[model samples]
Target chain A: MTGIELRGVEKAYGGNKPVIENLDVQIEEGSFTILLGPSGCGKSTILRMIAGLEKETAGEIFINGIDMRGVSPGAREIAMVFQNYALYPTMTVKENIEFGLKNIKVPKPEREARVGEVIEMVGLTEYMNRKPQHLSGGQRQRVALARAIVKKPKVFLMDEPLSNLDAKLRAQIRTDLIELHRNLGATFVYVTHDQVEAMSMGTDIVLLESGRIRQQGAPESIYSAPKNLFSAQFIGSPPMNIIKAENLEHGGASLPPGTVSLGFRPEKVIVSGEGRAPERGQISFRGELVAREILGDHAIYKFKTAFGCIHTKTMSGSTVEYGKWSVRVDAKYLYYFDEKGDVIK
Target chain B: MRSQSGVFWRTFGKACRLAVNLLIFAVFFVPFYWMFLTAVKNLGQTLRLPPAFWVSAPHWENFGKVFDAIPFFSMLKNNLVMTFGIMICQFFTVIPAAYAFARFKFAGGRFLFGLTLATMMIPAQLVFLPLFLMFSKMGLVNSYASLILPWATSSFAIFMLRQTFKQVPQELIEAAKLDNASEWKIIFKLMLPIAKPTIVTLGLITFILNWNDYFWPFVLTTNNAVRTLPVGITSLNIVDGGVKYHILMAGNVLLVAPALAVFLFAHKQIIKAFTYMGGK
Candidate 1:
């Protein structure tokens, strides 16, 4: 059974322009599905629709096979962790955790037990009596997580929950979330603009742009086999470099018809000595070395070529000279896109 | 050397601020001091030339004379009923209205809020004549309802609360909804507590405005049976006979005491509330 399903869902504030236009998504049971997109891409809007916080302008949503057309958010049996960690300011950590249970009329003993268990799970046992103001940013985030989990909702939705934390703390919480997802065995739909978070934690990734799904697949598959130019550029840091097919001087390889753009990941380019012979089905370009950025373990070398600026990632300890250099790209690693930006299969 | 100059400048600024504040306090404090002194002076001493700064023998009996001149207890009762009644009714009306203005998206919401604000600009004198006629037709004159009904919905209170409520993050409301809390629970439990300081400030403002209101109560009520303290105190100013200056001052003192006590109790909250408003 699907944990959550959105069929032809459309959301618009008013007038004719729909933010999310005729979208269909199915989150498989117990899978960690990530809604990944840049800001204002309507990823948070989709999460809100599923939680019944915002109504879809058209179409149906289902949770556990139950239609959620007019269901209140609470009745949908979905819990959401907000970016702001919206723990009730007046309530203590314990009260915030038990708030939903009390509202749903859960018995006293079970509610307390569940609150205690979830609090312990989040490692907030010592800070249970403190209000949200007294807790640090990370601690408040844990309280929000515990509050959502205590309800034991069938699905958990998080809207950039770790974005507010510092880098180290975000990483720590990301690992914690993954482990929690494994232990709970419940569907988790996380929304974030951070590609790193999506790649590290998501079992299935749905990439969105301007409210439309660009690609949906496992992290590795999306990274390796991006279906279009947007997916290629959006999924990677220092994004995929696109070189117009006209600018590239191919090494006697037959070009596909209707190919307007050729793309390759930064790490895919092989930097070698200028005199090295190009291997079979490999293209080589010799260009002036423009700049280099040392990123601890790896160095990114930017070169000015006839095609454009081509960035190559090499090991930091490599003793490569700074003048002219030959950069090689295997034909197999090249991605071709048509004028409409669709991949040329 | 820089630190030394910084300290000197800071102390100089502090001294200037203290001097200015003292000057402002004296301006406001002098009138209250004169009123207190006049309230305690005998009728003979009250009319003395240059006005006695302090009463030699404080006539506390003037306070008793105020009660004798008018039904003070009935007036107190009337004042409490009207002030509290308006406050309670305003709470029920304004909170939901403010919340709607702040959070809900609907057609004409902005226009209606603008209209409510527009009502605030319309002077009370402009509306009182029409309102008084309407009450007279309904035979509500000289009744607590007459005093309470017109002032029940305070536009200032609603406007202040809406601003405060808008500051509450939308995420909090969404979280509450996800927690199975109904709209009522969301307002009273979540929004209300978060807006407590503002509500207290509004309540304090409302209490003082209604308590010290002389014109409306004077126009609305005719006899001692329903007159509030401010209007009731006017009875001490006899038209045919000479005004009992000391007794009237004593009556004014009695009238001002409740508002003064309320302000003292909630001054901290009021200051905090205004600070929040200014910061926002």
Candidate 2:
């Protein structure tokens, strides 16, 4: 088990225009670290560099305190599962899982024993004779996992391995991966553009934006104390709505007077009951409910407020109407951002 | 009631498709039929008024005469040597070159590959005279080196193989690399296995082109020792005794047989190779 550390890693396709610049990250051993961001944020690039698939233009990579300079991907002692699974289509599931073993010159009987063990581990014993194309998306993903883990590599690098599966399968595999990590105790560095995957599966999340680290911490800490506006907006689902609102604080704390963009999570916002007024909440916005989406258990209401548009999720059984509504923002959930979109701590 | 016009239009479409396909097959297979007929026709029956479609007796001895009239065995050997040699050479030259062009990023690779593709558009005739002169200067004009050497380095093979190599997933190659495979193992074990279909197509094409080659052999070789099949057949056209039309046709059948058999068995793969390369 070994941790990966990137120090001042930078990459550019010449021309002095860097794709990833001055990036620093430290991933702990036996920890599932997800480099999460939107597309082209260079999360995948960082993963590739760690796998030695892509060369860093400038930086040093360390694995278990050993400098990983000028090392080829073959010698990296790391296994990577690609977004597409990247299984050898010509080989059967058994052969694909055994490819690395064969390459390392493992003896025939030991290789077969290891392959059989992983096949059962991934629940793919029945599909061992099948090719990758013959397997479903989820099954192929499992075969990829089986192939990676069978090697018992010091590090596992998965680049959006679950993104290709259907929604239900993605969620299912997410649970399976978390369980697998616990049992194996191998260090995992996962990269994904899906914030939900990062938040749910990663023990530590490294939020990236424009090829740089936006924030890094445990999932709960990053979710609650997001270091920046991008980190806050990116970490949640249905996204954190940003409304241009006035900080009309009469007696809170001494603050500068300037327009601030109010950020609050929709799940935290509550619609006041007909006769029951909201208390202990310092913020309330009155607006016309423009639209509503009833998603089985909860209904998300879209409103045109005085500040801007606000979205609040209320229980679907609640008797909220379309015309007028008062949404209460819990004081602790309200985040203020300056005009430049930086979080105003 | 089934509409009369709808039924008529449907029948007409089916007949049109059948007619078009018949025309295509005829256009492709007529020369082969004619060659086969000529190989078995006698001198007098070959020039008969109606152009003999059926003969009274099969002239099996005409094939023997083709061998008797010329050094058929030696000519066959030369053609086989050149064809197989070129094919084997291309297997080596094309696969690695293709892998490099498809998978790696080296300085000037794009410029070099572009230069290779640019050579494809230029006619072989344009380079024939200069290449012949260069080979003569190198004292390689009369040997098999003159025949097989120039073909051993092909731009088109590199181009075809590069397209095939590109279709192999980058992930597989990277996986192989991570397995402690040098680039050589990745090419031989991973890339080659995944690209079996494309490799067969390249081999067939390289064989066909070399077997049917005449102009290069005619220009470079002055004697029958190094002459390929097509060139050998042309020499049989104006032999010392007379125009041995039957013998010429027998030689033609021999020349076409191997290529025809290869194409028939692997036509789907050949067409797919064309489609794959054309798309690129």
Residues B127-154 of candidate 2: C-alpha lDDT, one tens digit per residue? 9999999999998986888899889968
**What ranges in model 2 sit over 4 Å off?**
A247-259, A273-281, A338-345, B126-142, B240-242, B276-280
Candidate 2: fnat, from 0 to 1?
Answer: 0.83
- Cα error of candidate 2 at position A21, Å: 3.5
The chain A TM-scores for the candidates, taken one by one, are: 0.95, 0.92
Residue B92, model 2: lDDT of 81
Q: lDDT values of the candidates?
A: 0.91, 0.85
True contacts kept of 1: 0.90
Residue A48's lDDT within candidate 1 is: 93
- Candidate 1 residues lying further than 4 Å off, grouped into runs, are A250-254, A274-280, A319-322, B1-15, B50-52, B104-111, B239-244
Candidate 1 per-residue lDDT over residues B183-251, each given as its tens digit: 889987899998998998998999998989999999999888988989888878874568778788899
What would the TM-score be for candidate 1 when compared with the true structure?
Answer: 0.92
Give the winner by DockQ: 1
